[model samples]
Target chain A: MTLAAASHGFLSPTGVEIAFVLVGIATLGAALQTVTSRQLVHAALWLVVALGGVAVEYLLLTAEFIAWVQVLIYVGSVVVLLLFGLMLTKAPIGPSPDADSGNRWAALTVAGASAAALVWVVVDAFRATWIDLDGTVQGSAEVSGRSLFRFWVLPFEALSVLLLAALVGAIVLSRRGGDAKGAAETSAPAAGEERH
Target chain B: MHLAYPAVLAVLLFCTGLYGVLARRNAILVLMSVELMLNAVNLNLVAFDVWLRDALHGGQALTLFTIAVAAAEIGIGLAIVLLVYRNRGSSDIDRLRDLAERPAGPAGAAGSREAQPDTGAEATA
Candidate 1:
C-alpha cells in the first residue's frame, strides 16, 4: 500500500513530500524543545537535533551541497562550540532555575503574531508557484561552485575575512583576563620600586 | 513540494527562536536562539532558490554566505559570553545591568580614579 504511494509520478504528491512534512514537524518540535528546555546541556543537545533536521530538509529540497555544509558547520562545529561554552562557563548541567525570565507570556505573544504574519504573507505570495524538480539538478556541487565563485566571489572572500576576524576577536576576548592578571603581577614589582 | 510548505516551516522555526531570545535569561541559550533564527533564514533562501529556477542559483550561494557569517557570529558571541561568565561568575543576562548610568558617589569617583593608573599601565604593557 505504501509502496504504491511511493511510486506515484511527478504529477501527484509522493513519498518525498510525505518525508518533507515529517522532517519539518520533527525539526519544529526539536526547535521548540531546544528553546524551552531547562537544562543548558540538554538544550544544546536538542539544538543539535534541530540543526540536523534542517540539514535533512536541505537535502530534501535537493540542495545537496548546502545540506552537507549545514551538517558540517552547524551540527558539527557550532553545537560543539556551544557545549564548550556552557561547560567552560560552569553552567549547571542540570536544570537551571534562572534559565528563564518572567517575560515568557509576552515573548510568546510577539513570536506567535510575527509567525502568523510571515506565514500568511509567504503563502499568499507563492500559492500558485510550483518548482519543476525534474529539470537540471541545481543542488550539485559543480553548479553551486560556479555560482559561488563567479558572481558571489566578492561576498565569499569577505566572509572568509570576517571569519578570520571573529577567530582573533574570540581569542582576544577570552584571554583578556589572563592578560590582565599577568600585567598586574608584573606591574606590582614596578609600583613597589617606584614607591621606594 | 509546495513552496508554502518550507516557507511556513521557516516562519515557525524563526518565531520559536524569537521567543527563545526574548525569554531566555542565560546568554548561551540566547546565542543558540540566534542560530535557530539564522537556520530559518537559510531554509527560506534555499526554498526560494529552488522555486525561482535561476541559472546562477543565487539563493543557495547566498545561503552559503549566511552560514559562514553565522559561524563567525556564534564564535565571537560565545567568547564574549564566556568572558562575562568568568568576570561576573554568572551568565544571566538579567544580572548584567551595569551598562546603565548611575549618579557618581564620592566613593565611586575615587574608585574610578584609582583604577585609571592601573589601566594606563596595562595599556602600555
Candidate 2:
C-alpha cells in the first residue's frame, strides 16, 4: 500500500483518534495516581500502569519498536528495580502519613504555571503542523537502528557505559550498608566475648 | 493528526511530575516523579520527530538513549536513597538538615566531622 493512501485511509474519522484520546486520558490518570498514591507499592504499580499507557501510546503512533522497548525497559526493569529498592529500604507497604509535604498548594501553583507555559508554547509553535505519517516508516526498528548506529553511535555507547557505572554505583552503595551491619555484628560478638 | 493532542498530554504529564517532585515526601516517590517528567520529554521528542518527518528518525533514536539514561539515573538515585534510609532510619528530606551550618562550637564541629566519614566511605565503596 502507498504511504499517502494508507494515511488517508487511516486518518479518516474513526476509532484511532478516539483510542488515542482514551489512552492519553488513561495515561494521565495513571501518572497522577502514581505520584499521589500514599502506599509505596501502590505507587509503583500505578507507575507501571502509567508507563504501560505510554507504551500503548507509542504503539498507537505506529512506533512499535519504541513501544516494546518502553515495555521491556520501563515496565519490565525500572519498576522492578524500584520495587526492589522499596523493599530493601523497607518503605511502608501501606498508606504513609508522611508521603505528602505541606507545600502541595505551592507546588501545584508552580506546576500549573509551567504546564500552561509549555502547552501554550508548543501549541503555538506547532499549531499548523501535521505528522506526515504517509512518508517513510520512521518508527521501524531498521530505521531507528540505522539512525542510532550511524549518527548516534557515540552517545549510544556512552549510554551503555553510563548504565554500567550506575550498576556498579548501586552495588557499592547498597553494599556499604551491608558492610556496616556486618562490622557491627562482628564487633558486638567480640566485645561480648571480651566481657565474659 | 493535530500535534496539539500529544503536546498537551506531555505538558500535563510534565506538570504532574513537577508537583510530585515538589510535594512528595518519600524519596522513591520523588524518583518516580522524575521518571514521569522524562517520559513527557520522550513524548515530545517522538511527536516532533514524526511531525517533522525527518529521514534520520533522530527523535526516536534520542528517545532510546533517553530511556537508557533514565534507567541509569533511577539505579543510582535509588541507591543513594537506600543509603540515606540505612543511616537515618527515615527518608524524610526535611529531617536531613544536618548539612545546615550549626552554631560555632566544639560540639557542632565534632558532630559534622563525625557525619562525614560514613558518607565518604560509602562514596568510595
By TM-score, who's the top model here? 1
Off by over 4 Å in 2: A1-14, A177-196, B101-125
TM-score between model 1 and native: 0.84
Q: Using alpha carbons, what is the TM-score of model 2?
A: 0.83
Residue pairs that clash (backbone atoms under 3 angstroms), model 2 = none
lDDT of 1 at A6: 46
Error at A104, model 1, angstroms: 0.9
Write one digit per residue (lDDT tens) for candidate 1, span A1-196. Answer: 2343244444666576789889999999999999999999999999999999999999888999999999999999999999999998888868878788999999999999999899899888866656656678878899899888888888888888888999998888877436665676485544322322
Q: Candidate 1 falls in which docking quality class? A: medium
Model 2, span B1-125: residue lDDT tens: 56677888989999999999999988888999999999999988888888777777888998998998999899899889977776667777766665667667679778778768755543233
lDDT of 2 at B114: 77
TM-score of chain B of each: 0.80, 0.80
lDDT per residue (tens digit) for residues B1-125 in model 1:
66678999999999999999999999999999999999999999999899788887889998999999999899999988876675556788987765444466568878666666755653333
Q: Residue A174: error of model 1 in Å?
A: 1.4
DockQ of 1: 0.52
